[model samples]
Target chain A: MMTADERGEIEELLPWHAAGTLDRREAQRVEAALAEDAELARRYQLVREELVHTTHLNETLGAPSVRALEALFAKIDAEPQRRPGTAPGIAMRIGEFFASLSPRALAWSACAAALAILLQAAVIGSILIKEKAPGSYETASVPTSPGTEGTDVLMRFQPQATVSDINRFLETNKLSIARGPSAGGIYRVHVSGAKLSKDEATRVLNTLQQNRIVGFVAITH
Target chain B: MQTNSDEVLIGRIAKGDRLAMQVLYGRHHVQVYRFVLRMVRNETTAEDLISDVFLDVWRQAGKFEGRAAVSTWLLSIARFKALSALRRKPEEELDEDAVGAIEDHADDPEVALAKKDKGAALRTCLSKLSVEHREIVDLVYYHEKSVEEVAKIVGIPEATVKTRMFYARKKLSELLKEQGIDRGWP
Candidate 1:
């Protein structure tokens, strides 16, 4: 005769046993108990029935819509990329800091940052021009304004390329977004440092074209 | 890439690999959606919560210590989000459509008596279980999770997992008996 505690223990193991998730020893014990005890066998049958019903109930719930994936990617694109090897607490604090800002504040902050970058670029360009010897300058097909003396390449990013991917790509190529993403999802990318000669410009365009993240690239002028 | 183990995919995801994230999402989203749907009961809420769950995955992939299965980690994140969502909308009662649907299955004791489909009756009883009991039942039977995995996902003790499972099964049997489909057990 099975003790009450023994019966309860076997009863608790039955669900896991029916699920095929019990360890071998517990499973063997349950099997042995079932063989010797008709009552335990009946209980195991009920457990199996419950498993079928539960599985059926869950299966009928169906899969999520495509919108779920789309929404997830959209949110990811909006998130600031965490630096590699950054501590979790620091990253979360950074995220929280940005999240705490209002939209207007964020926009104003972005505008101020953009102005700082443009001013710094102008200063750097002037200094480089002053340091160069006359007649040593290479001519490009397109003439740039004094403050904007960089190769302008129009590029389109792949649809699946995220903001982090774009940032990494730009940093590696020493490029910055100079203008519109326009209606066509194209961005005018400014290659920093010296204005490229035609061959150099073509090489840069080719590099962008070959990259996985850039779906299209061309020297706009 | 499709054949990569979940841990491999999670490792890649931790490095900010979009393709890896997409693969992991494809592999698990259906079951995760179903699990959240069972908790939230509204398809729209469940769909939104699925996005939230995976967004957490993308943000926290690096923190996964391999202490639990990837699926268990996902369900844990999903359960936390679902519970928070539930808490935010405490005034929103149980889904009326679902309640009505259950009633439609057996309008009265007389109709329940007339219903001879034990499987259908049992399914109705499963649906009628309290959320706590239903969650435990689904975790064990439907998700086919081990007791340890369920304890991790549910954030309860292993011993508590066993007792909860026993109680959940006992309650399910009682519900079946009430529906006139008793397969005799305490």
Candidate 2:
């Protein structure tokens, strides 16, 4: 008589054996046991039935609607693309490089970075005050700065445009990303240096709209 | 793209290749959707969860170390997302239409027995299984995953996977017996 534990062991392997996922040894064992045990053979038959039923059940569940893929792609388009070479390795290497610096050198570097930030902040504050001065005609634009109060423009890049194409376009236009690619793939690009007058801003917007790389551009007010 | 191995596709996806993402999604999205649908029992939620699952795949493709088959990896992610979704909305009920459909087949023991289509009866019983038991059955039988693969996807020990599979089958047998279709073993 097959021991209870042995029967149980073979019983568990029966499903895998029916599914044909068992390795040779386990398959052989289960087959050998099936030959000897009528009860085990009956259980194996039931496993086969369950396997068939389960397969049919899942097959009937069907595929998700195409809308699922459309939504997925839209989310993907909105997500900021991680550049090819900017894997964790780059961050780790930078970490190692900083770790290798002498304590004194690191402290001096930190101090220099703090001083630079303070100087940039002072310049930005002065520019903001100047923009808001007594007789200045206030523009409806949201004040964002790349070291100075500047007009933020909302622009959508062409889907086919590569990151390099975007970087080159931004450089050529002297615009910096202040925020976004929001859910709509619109970026808030800051025109650096002086804020533009309404006509100059409209002219810049018209120019951006004409570029093949830009699909839409609007002066954010 | 169709011929590229899943690992190769994942490598390309890690580099922000949208075409590769589309290919991988095409290859596996149905299975992932079905798996999540089985767990959540709602089509809309399953559709939403699948989007989240593939989005994770797109974002974390670089983290896939090829220790598991791509299908297994996808199911693992799907399982995690489904379970998290279930937890967040714990009171969410089974899809009434699905339950009604299955019940129509097996709810009346006499009707089930009269139909004499053991396959339909078996399927209705399979649907009646607890989430844990149903998942084990589906992964092993429908997905044809190995014990190790099921363990990895379900995050359980291989031994537990076997026992769970055994119990799931046993429970299924008991369910069949309730429908007056005994297969003669405990």
Candidate 3:
């Protein structure tokens, strides 16, 4: 007694139902229809036969090249981290990278940190001293190199911004450079303060976008 | 015993763990490579895209929203990249190998289902299915994807997926019929 339109709809769902892809509710409905309908049951059997044929056919594809894995590993090593548009596993890497550092490396890192603090203090003092001479500031990016260890984000240089403008911008934000000014003029910048929360990263991107010396900033790690 | 799930591996991959990436690549690379090879009909391009697909996984593992299984997500990414690669190639360039792969089947209707080689006959008829039909069948049967998953991966509506499946099923049955193997249903 099922209407033709109703049967057609059920028929359309039959293959998927047989293939076991339907949601539980829909599968149950198909089961209910099939129990009462001989034609529907036959269609389901045909779908099953087709499925069997296709599955067997796909098995004939041979395995891929043996060199595929080696080539993939090489390419991964060669390419710098391109901050994905999605969330990156950066937080975990930061922890692991630091944990694996040797004691000597840790001591060297501490000394380097001290030197950086001193240099930053001096830089800030210079900006204060030159408060009256704003245009005389040095042009330095936040993270000054392309592939600095521990640095993962990227920021492109704005077309017309002067060095002094970039320096002033960094000074105002209290951000430090990790590395860059690659041939293409992109800088690898460190997130100022602690690890960047999602909201904080978005805010930083928005802030950079508004700054005249920054263009196309992104978290690439 | 419980195995480390793909989600857990992706979590580690997001953190820049190369080992995690290698583990994931080992788990899914072959299926992905096979899928790509089937589509492009070129081993070199298929191999190259396998790297590209896994590289995207390594780079974008953090973006996975868990809306679909990791395997499904990987296949979707593979499908997109394969289609893009296909579009970039000249149409005439696909002429020989891809076309020949399908038409090379024996034309003799008498031998279509010669009971001694039904499996081979089915495979030949399968190769003859249009790319669209072949993909639908592959998604449903070989990949074991649900209609919704197939719809998501193929970028078609659920209804369209069913319709495509119906036609693909019909076409496959028709091809089998031509080869003397009608299964008495459709």
lDDT against the true structure, each candidate: 0.83, 0.83, 0.76
Worst 10 residues of 2 chain B by lDDT: B97-106
Q: A1-221 in candidate 1: lDDT tens per residue?
A: 67787788788989999999988867887899999999889889999999998999899888999999999999999988868874333443455478789999999999999999999999999988886767666568655553457678888997646688899999998889988789899888888567788998888788778776788888866
Better of 1 and 3 by DockQ: 3
On residues B15-97, what C-alpha lDDT tens digit does candidate 1 reach at each position? 78899899899999998999888877888999999999999999988776667788999999999998888888655475764
- Which pairs clash in the backbone of model 1? none
- Candidate 2 per-residue lDDT over residues A1-221, each given as its tens digit: 67787677778888889999998867887899999998778878778878887899999998999999999999999999687574423433465479789999999999999999999999999999998898987655755443347788988997646688899998998888988889889998997467889999998888889886798888887
TM-score of each: 0.64, 0.63, 0.61
- Ranked by DockQ from best down, the candidates are 3, 2, 1
Clashes of each: 0, 0, 13
**What would the per-residue lDDT of candidate 3 be over residues A126-164, giving only the tens digit for each residue?**
877887485665556654345434324688876545577
Using TM-score as the measure, name the better of candidate 1 and candidate 2. 1
DockQ of each: 0.31, 0.31, 0.32
Q: Give the winner by TM-score.
A: 1
